[model samples]
Target: MKAAMIFDMDGTLFQTDRILEASLHDTFQLLRDEEKWEGDTPLETYRDIMGVPLTDVWKTLLPLHPTHVHERVNDVFQDKLIQNILGGMGALYPHTEDLLSYLAERGFPIFVASNGYPRYLETIVEYYALDRWIISSYSIEDIDSVDKGELIRKVKADHHLSHGIVIGDRRSDFKGAEANEFLSIGCAFDFSQENELREADVVVDDLIEIRDYLEKVK
Candidate 1:
C-alpha cells in the first residue's frame, strides 16, 4: 500500500495564527466585559503555546484560573475562530493547495491529526474544501486524548493504514511519528522553535518542498 500522509492543522497546513490573534482579542474583550479575566491579556502570547494540547494551552495562559474558566474561554475562542474562518479571515499556507493536489493525484491518502476542537476542525475542513484532498481528519476532540502519538495510532488502526509519514511544524508532530515508527517531515517555515524539529526525519522550508521530497522518496 502507498504510504499515507498525516498532517497537523495549525502551523503545517492551516495558517491558524492569522485568525487566532483576532479571535483572541475578541475573546479577551468578552472576558473583560463579563469580568471573567482580570487583565488586558495574558503574560504569554498564543505562539508560546502553539502545538500543545488545549488543556495545556489553558494551563499556560490561565495558570491560576479554574477548569470552568478555561472551558468558558475555549467556548468563546472557538466561536470567534469559527466566525473568522467562515468570514475568510485566515488561509492555508502558500502552495499548500498545489502540494495537496500533487499528493492526491499520486493516490496518497492524506489525513489530519490536530489538537483543535471539533467545531473548529469541521469549519476548517469544510471552509477550505480540504475534504477534497483528505481521506479523513481526526482531532483531540474526536479521540478525547491529548497525546498526538495515541491519536496517530487511532487513525492508523481505524483507516487500516500500515505505512505512513507524519507532517507538521512542531515537536509533537515529530514525536508522534517517532512513537509510531514512521518517518516525519517537519515544516520549518511555520510556528515551531528552531530546535523543535531536530528530531524530524526530514525538514522542509516550504509546502512545495514537501511535494518534491515525497516524490523522490515515493
Candidate 2:
C-alpha cells in the first residue's frame, strides 16, 4: 500500500460511549458492592480520558485501590464490554459500512488504530464485519507508550506509506497526525467536543463526508 487511511475505532467508527459506560458500571458493581463503591459507577469523569489505556483509566477511577484490584476491575471490565458487544448492545455510526465498502472497493488501504485492547478491537471488527475492509489493526496494548503518536507512526512506516491520513475523534489523534505531519481529519460528531479537535488539519461532522473530502484533496 502506498498510502493508508488509518481510523480510530471507538468514537470514530463504533458508537461506544453509551454501551461502554454501562459495561464500566457493571464491572464496578462486580468489584465492590453498590453501597461501598462510593464513586459513581459510570463516572462522567471518564469523559476526558476516553482515548487512554485501561490501566491508567483504572488508576484515575480509583487512586486508593491496589494494583491487583485495578487489574481485577480491568479484567472484569473487558469481559463485560466484550459480552455487551457480543450481545449486540453497541452499534456502528451511520454510513460506516457503506463508507468502508466504498473505500475498500476503490482500493484505499484502511487500518484501525486504537487505544483499545487487542481483543476488544478484534471483537468490534469481527462483530461489525469491518474485517472485510480493514487491512490490519493496532492497539496501545501492543505499544510501550500510551502516546498514540508512536503507534500512528509505526502504522505509517510499516506499510511503506509516504502519504496517509488519520481519522479520529480525540485530541491525541489530532496531535499524533499533526506531530507526524500526516493529514488529519477530526470527527466532530462523537466524543470530540469544543475545540478538542482544534489541532486537526480538517474536521468534519459526518463520517461519510470523509470520502468526499479526501477525494477532493487527493
Best by lDDT: 1
Local error of candidate 2 at residue 215 (angstroms): 2.6
After aligning candidate 1 to the native by TM-score, how far in Å is the CA of 204 from where it should be? 0.8
Estimate every model's Cα lDDT from 0 to 1: 0.87, 0.85
| Candidate RMSDs in order | 1.4, 1.6
lDDT of 1 by residue, 111-214 (tens): 99999877898899999899999988898877757899999999999989888999999989999998988889999865877788888999988989988887
Q: What is the TM-score of each candidate against the true structure?
A: 0.95, 0.94
Instruction: Give the per-residue Cα lDDT of candidate 1 at 195.
Output: 89
Encode model 2's per-residue lDDT on 40-123: one tens digit a residue. 675676777787778888889888888998888888888988999999999999889988998898888999889999999999
Whole-model alpha-carbon lDDT for candidate 2: 0.85
- Cα deviation in Å at residue 100, candidate 2? 1.0
